[model samples]
Target: MKKIGIGICIGIMCFSSFFSYGNEQVLPHHHQIQKGSASYIETINQEKNRYVNYGDGYMIDYPSHMEVDTSLEAVRTLIKDQEREIEIYYDNFHNTPNSAPAYKNYSNAFIKNTKDHIKEYENTATINGMKVHLLKWSRKKLSKVSNDKNFYVSAEIVKNDKEVYTIFIKSSRQFYNFEDYMDVISSFKIIEKKGNPSINTKFKPVERKLNEETKEFYYKYFVNSDKLRWGIFEQSAPASFSYLKGIENRLDYEFKFLVRYQSLDVPMPLEELKNAYNNNRYVELTLQTMHMNEENESITYDILDGKYDDYFEEYAKKIKEFNHPILFRLNNEMNGDWCVYSSYYSSKDTNLYKEVWKYIYHVFEKNGVDNVLWVWNPHDLSFPNFKWNHYLTYYPGDEYVDIIGLTGYNTGNYYPGEIWRSFEEVYPHVYNEYMDIFEQPFMITEFGSNEIGGDKVKWIHEMFDYMYMHPFKNIKVAIWWNGIDWDPLRNPARIYRLDNREDVMDTFRQRLKDYK
Candidate 1:
């Protein structure tokens, strides 16, 4: 993903050569070089050039030697030298969904519009406080022009609330000096709009007591369950709602879990949460504090070291207002290397993770948010070369946690050298290990298997059978992750959706009915 940006930059140059004109070519209306405009020319001739404001919401600095192009639509500006070129464009399509989906549409359009083969694409780069999606490919024109000289290209796309901006940098992979152009691209900045809402710092602590209905539901469904409560997690809210409606009609059982993700610094969607509660579902909120970059850990110890007390308090107050029992999985899968709170990124300081957990739990308690059932979740111990081996160390003690949660998956050859594993093989070892240490009821917070290397129907049957017949009988909740694992613009993994698979759905429906 990181390398794709660099590759696309060079590949675009081949396409550029066809459209680009020589120095003698007449300039466009916007970029006309006026005669006797010494001041403007002088500005462009300086070693460290002055910032060019595009009259849009962006400004950037370029080298004195480069030429700026202004003819292209959605392209804010373009700068080019002999060996390298950079193009900046912005999209304000009101009809498009979120940044991620818009990015996918743009990537597909680029491939279709320009006949270039995108070898790699990744949304991994973060620049100017915004996440950037990158695409890389080799130009088809280069193959026709010269067999010996292959042109590679890369593009970096950044999205804000209003618009999506792309920085297309093209250079010769062999001869271009990347460091020189990178400095110019890094200087790009977005002008702040007026009247942007500021983060609420004042802690408006609410004094709302827990609803008796919420307490009754929690006690009945979670604390003393006759059989495992079933649920499904889809990518979007509408999809999840539709899936639940369909499954409920077919199976004659209502879903008990509504799995949702809460990103860092973003407030919980109170309206959506309320709607889920109205539907009589328990929200399994996975509080994600980290961004995608594992190396660039955002949630540091200092930030969690009592600095955001007001923020946490306000968040707790909001949860209290919801007044529904939620399974709050804070920093879930802490033992895994993917999360920022994990010991792998925290200098192997599992104690810091525990401290952060305790701090958040304390804030919720302080704000009278007793409806939250704190779930201490960690990934299963089956992952190879797992850094945090002692899962007990990550625990914030038995008092803070109301339920022990585990995330186990039958990847089934999702990655190279990955073998198909049965349900028992994926989770039994970790379940037994945790059972020996914690007395709290267990929940498989996230569980699914792929139909790639093995039979998903058989795997689902095995999972249900094990849960029904297991002697421990403490595992009371299981949430199936129903989503597409393999997307064209991103990496591929396990596909866990069972709704479309009638065989699997029938087996699941029967198992739900048969389970005692």
Candidate 2:
């Protein structure tokens, strides 16, 4: 983790008051405010402070005056003032099934390791909606050359089912202000847990079309058949095609090629399309219209304002002129927070997102781009902040969509303190949830897992097994994200290719043979 300097001045004085609970005291911050209360309104207004996402399932608000260092291997986050320091540690403990035991073991280890005298300690305390163990201790200077000096420490240990977060704050006794630091501690909250639904809705059906070649391919592999169509995505079409040639040579099978076009800056790569067509391979084109630089904010206003009409019209003309059957997936993974069109920034207004989708589809249709097989994609609704009912609301109607595409990944511990999940655990819920609503063929537009923290070979093998045994019998296309996940911010980049790991590659080849 590298240290990125971000300045933000947060005025906490407005909500600096505290409330007592039993023997403990807690801050009346954003998390504590009631929905319609005055404090909630004030908190919302004052939420302009910078937030640091740990990517490990949690995020926290830090004041601008503090320097944050996330580069430490052991500590997830390091926040420092002139002399006062805060260290956040993300610990992975596999055997512990519950929080109580995990907290006790970690607390004992911390006390022993630091050689500190415990002035006060509480085995249980509630902070930021999590049950934590609190410890306040002090250590005196033992150096013979040094005069009498004392250092104060306040620590909180928060344990989840799979991980533990230890937040340690240290300062000289003269500078130690427990209340001020407590405000920072209370700002921490877990952001990656499964979403809790407040409502449910039926899945809306969409009508779509496929070209002659695409229809034949779908029938042969997916419709009324158990055979799976294998696909791969690389950074470039040439790279993907090269990888496909290697796979075909190894397994004696050809694969569908997946290509992605992002932002308004880059037009469709005609060379890539020509290469795929010339090589007798089908292409799955993912058209990402969202702005490349912006992911956190909503672009709904731009879409509704028709600011990109000329861009869409030109793209639509190109698609029509190309005159080849391609699986056109527009704005895939729209339900996930990583996209600008997601409900997170759209104020949970799915209708606005759907309008944008419909507008894009209408542009293509108006341009007579009939060769495109429209694929409507959304991230699995089980992800945090995604509501199940909201998933259906993003539908651009059956007339605009042809197939349902879903994206899922076994991310492992890519983020600090994240759990290593299996393929089955990450994808099945979405399939089960949507299968009954829409009577259309399914396609996994993106799927892969990190090699670290879990068995990638076993994960791949199980993915094929699950696909073969899947009850809906609608899943036709499964594409593996073959490129290296080179995001510098995330730990353990998820490499999901069959080229390097012989065991995993052999498993994939053998599984494809079995499917055949």
Candidate 3:
């Protein structure tokens, strides 16, 4: 999933190539320019969201739930699943007497991009004060596999000024409310803002808390505190305690938490939780909605429809009875295509992802499960990193999440395309981004260096040094994944164990002894 996510995000995401407005790298009123930046749209108080693209210098009240796609050179596509999309094109908006109006090219760009369509309705009218060329069309034969004559609506309004824009949106199944498209067209605006654009940092976390004593204790001692807890996940979760016990004995160093990965195909990790809590350690559950052995199945839709309500309800009851602060990380690394819950499988509809999260969160809340600190996690990078599939798009919001969990790994050269990553390379880039925007505490939910990559010893030693650096903020816990990711063909593909060598254990022992 890490490799898949990295490939998609890095290859598909780019913010530049939109039109410029004013003299100071601003957007023109209706002109086209193919050189600008991108600030993808998202997040709000769950209201009718007005997204402000600080990078492109535009503000529009787009439905917050919808996804944005800016992978195109000078186009911003607002999409609602596979069927509906709004393409906003920005081209060179300057005009010369010797040639056609630059804004006139907005219509041409639209025609150049869209193909194989039959026009249903073509007319001209002023819907939102701006005269628009209205068009409604459809493609009867979608493809060889499916003849989904999915409906399409389109229009073009080019002006003498640089204010030219192609208008189009995908409608639902066979029909759509025309007013919806009109409203979207009217909402477009190009303006100026002062500072550089950033991920929304003005966000305020929802006021959710646990029992008074525990809540206060956690906030004071753990969340955002100077204390850093070392965590681990062994090869087999059930035998993890026995394996971890050996490590604890070797260096007289105890891990504060244990991490486990489980899919919803089985029961919750009651025994694992018991093992950790009994031993005075916390447990981080990397919960997933897919079948553990079968990666193809995704039950996110079923989960939303309440098919698994009883399952979660039972777990909620158990968790509350357990009465410990469980780091409940539901569906970690969601932005990766290798994850069943990613939008890649859902027609790029991330709303379903966010919906399942809120549904799960609400179920736990209804059962009064206060001991669970909801951990919303994403891969350090996004798969397809298209604006629609970005990690931020999957965030369930402040009220629903308590901790912002992060995951990255150095897989070494075990896989065909995998590469070794230094601690500095894997962490600081994402850390800096999260530090600016998130209010919740951070955790390296899962990470490790594969012995196949570079110097595993040096990686471990350098990891300790990096962790001790004071420049980082709000990072409370870091967990090492101490297991082998075996390839069917290459059996021992990647080894991440810290106790594989006395020298390696010595490295951790020496560094940890002086940590405090």
Candidate 4:
């Protein structure tokens, strides 16, 4: 829940198979990996393993099996025992300044991290007149056993006068075939549209250590779960648990997490965090980098320049002290204009945004603050809403994010120019867009229908109706924002509370039966 400017998956709709869950046909996120199905992995010596993607301009002939988990992001994964995934992604990156910092020690998917995470094994070659950077890394989980295997990652970056295309191939050590990456990577060909557009490749492994919060138990649990986890942010604090109890009574269910907001200008709000956790609730903290409305031209850039090092370090330490896992959303809704950290305030350069994001994550990493899962979120709607200001343009890349946060509020017809929007109008398209690009589970970090525009009760029913009709395979959590936004004249304008009326609350409770 944000004051104003806040925003928030390979959403792989992979290869799917429907199985009977009691009276219903259900499709879980982790379907059994098989050949010829949507989890299409080519079988060795099988022609079917070879898949060509005509959407972006590329084609490939993979070995053995093909695994396409369209539910979360990769185009395909490989073989029966072990797995390999191929993803062809296009970054609107012909405009990126040569000066911006990206994920992992200032390098993105195309460049190497060169840090303590992935062991660096780089290969740079000159092909004809083109300088191609082929970054290859073999990352092994550091264990004492000498026979332990490692996964391999390789990628290519190609750009013309338009889009920057990245070809990434990853080999899972589900079984050790060290040369697995070469089988598929060598066969990738970019179908040229113009006379001669260039193509290049590079990739490094993405690895991080957490303080006992294994990715298996936390992230994958959400990714594989079929149930929806509900949450909320009531307007009051300290007494928020009291309000949450009342909200639970109204909704007839318990919340998975309680949302909390904090500004980075202060030390971490350890007290508020403890307050939430003490009530036996998990916490999702949306940490804004600036003191509201005080962010100037230099704030985020100064963060890039190391202005708040001591503050952030102390903050990270406090979070580590909290011990429990937290859904950490930093500078969320970053693509929106209302946020101080958005590119709108930074010379319209989003690289500054990514750099600051990477900077803060590295701080947490350096401090061994591993109980937090990083959420990369952009608002469902952009404020300026230009191509340059698009949500994908602000992505820091996949390696740093564990969850994708979705925030789209039906602000209702409260303020001027705000119109009545159906529940259908708010989510489906935005959720689909993220599914095409990211391989992370999504959470509606905060959203609610205002009572002003139309029937809030009908809106609730429609929200659940759309869910039953279309399975949102990657969405694991949905948090309602139970609060109000005051108008300029200081009146309660957007009444988003679900408990205001008996009918509205009853509608949410009734319709929520199937989803939760």
Which model scores highest in TM-score? 3
TM-score of each prediction = 0.56, 0.58, 0.68, 0.61
Runs of candidate 4 exceeding 4 Å displacement: 1-207, 214-221, 237-239, 293-295
lDDT of 4 by residue, 444-476 (tens): 899998989798888888888887788687888
lDDT score, candidate 3, position 100: 22
Best by lDDT: 3
lDDT of 2 by residue, 1-516 (tens): 112221222334345665443355645443311111111111222432323332345545555456554332122445666656666555554663435454445344434423334455445678867877666655443322122223444444455565666566656445446565677677666655432211122234443454676666655655666656777776656434665677668876566656565676677666677677887766788777666665425356455666677888888887776777778888777766567666445333344567777777778878877677778887764223212214554676667777788787776776675677787787787787667566667888888887877888888878877766764466777888876665676643777666777787788778888544
Q: Pairing residues by index, what is the TM-score of model 1? A: 0.56
lDDT per residue for candidate 3 within 40-149, as digits (tens), equals 33232354444445454555545645554443322343444445655554332454222123333222222222333445666777644556667666543322112232
User: On a 0 to 100 scale, what is the lDDT of residue 296 in model 3?
Assistant: 40
Q: Report how far residue 137 has shifted in candidate 3, in Å.
A: 14
Off by over 4 Å in 3: 1-174, 177-197, 236-240, 295-298
